[model samples]
Target: MAVSYSFVAFFNSISSSYSSSFSKPSLGSLKPHYGLRVDSKNSSRRLVLSCSSSHMDSNSDTMDIGQTQVSSTAPFGLTMSEANMSRSSCKWQRVLLKVSGEALAGDRAQNIDPKVTMSIAREVAAVTRLGIEVAIVVGGGNIFRGSSWAGSSGLDRSSADYIGMLATVMNAIFLQATMESIGIPTRVQTAFRMSEVAEPYIRRRAVRHLEKGRVVIFAAGTGNPFFTTDTAAALRCAEINAEVVLKATNVDGVFDDDPRTNPNARLLDTLTYQEVTSKDLSVMDMTAITLCQENNIPVVVFNLSNPGNISRAIKGERVGTLIGGTRNSMAART
Candidate 1:
């Protein structure tokens, strides 16, 4: 009878052990020590283990349990660090970047400077790295300024402007080649048809290029005899549905007066489209400002000489003078 009792007791102990092993909560399903219940359906055991391991490793040096809880607030797929990193990385998906012909003249008397071209290319590449779609409208003043030359030589204004437009094409070729050299895909589109040299400007094609993250350089101005490249920039901005128009210039931002000539000149951080037109600010041509105002496109005037400003502007930073409708005020209030 005593031996039988001993056997029964042993069997009972074995059953209890098996039951405990099976019933014990899985670490993944384990509720927080507090009242919080773990969402087991949404997360797997492997993910919980990985997260726990990472948390432990991250706090190995410092035994801060609160940090781990803070890290857990993020969803299952991304850690707190990854979420913050993504927020910082977010940039404008579409932007129209206007680069003047004079900007292409990097320390040169006339025409395209290779160094300047490469510098601008590097800046553009940096923005593209952040996944921003960039469309460029280049001016032809570096190679030829129609107004100045026409005034001196008595050339017809329309003909001189056409010559200026052609100059932009040359700049576009140089820019395209430079950008391609740095492994960035580029497309050169001209308003004036030159099928052998470049694709004719097509609204759909330009939008497609931007969607694919390719740099679209619009050249030959509006293809009209009288329109300036500034006007072209505005037109492209609307067509491409860009969030903002980034006008890169020699000056960093718009000043109340010529900063170089007047030491007391104040840099305007923001201006309304109406104010720019009313004051007749010489930052962009009057026609360009009018188009931007009518279309409700924001214009950011920044210095191209400083590296990384273009990327900064596209990221929605206040690095330059912002000109547009009062719509931004409502956005800020929210």
Candidate 2:
């Protein structure tokens, strides 16, 4: 019995979730903001190269490693207020959700706080039930950061990055378990091949999964070293042609300064892609932001702490900072 129990625990730790793009808006209606900085042509070319190599290569969760497939229709039971009755009527049909690993860590010393994971799972669950196709790209900072790990250890950067990629796979497995437990049908696809744990990420296959209303989780980072998960999120967003990339962070929204340290920091409700790149906001890496700019895909940076904020953003209720092209461009689309 003890051996059997140990085997179950081992399976639960790693083999949990096995699961699971961008449209361009017109540029003519772009509303120029006060300050605009163009992304360097060099950076643009670099991004294109990074994405191109990925066509040559590729691109989470849980303890729920049970053999039984969870039912997708299980009641997530997210209450929508009458004020937000059209919550299901999202502005975009599909989106890529970028969740940081630190957010999943919560207050724990070890990686992954179960409560936070569950909360996020429920948020995704609610969105899936609302009929918006949800695809997720999760980071592994809570468990391991390749750069940091390399800095701390004497290991080479490339080796550390490979280990970090594995950490992302672990996170994907854990999330899969948590989401499945909530009755959401989740699929985990990896940039690197992990035949036993997840499906190899095929762009068309990922899109089909989204169309079928399955929440697809993207793990591993570009199947190559020296690439951050933010880049992975941006790449996946473009590949799948998602309407937007919703980056869920701990703080409420983008601010002039670090909200944690500066009492005077003010939340920004909206920002242009050019402004973000020019100002070098901590929202995401330059590569990720540049890709969004190139594709004209809006990114909503919001607080995952607030329950139901995902639904709010999707419903266009304005809960976080909306980053995209000129206001005129956005307005024309609406």
Per-residue CA lDDT of candidate 2, range 1-334, in tens?
3468888886555323210011222334333222212223432322221121112223311122224454434234534342134343567678899988888888766699888889988888767776778999999999889899786647989999999889889998999999999888899999989999999999999999988779999999788898899989999999999988888888888999987899999988789988898998988989889888898888888888888887776666677789983232233211
Clashing pairs in 1: none
| TM-score of model 2 vs. true structure | 0.71
lDDT, candidate 1, 13-110, per-residue tens: 85575445335635444332211222334423212221222122334232323235444443324555764565456455788999999888866665
lDDT of 1 at 160: 89
TM-score of each: 0.71, 0.71
CA lDDT scores, all candidates in order: 0.78, 0.77
CA displacement after TM-score superposition, residue 206 of candidate 2 (Å): 0.7
Show where candidate 1 strays beyond 4 Å: 1-91, 151-154, 325-334
Backbone N/Cα/C clashes per model: 0, 28
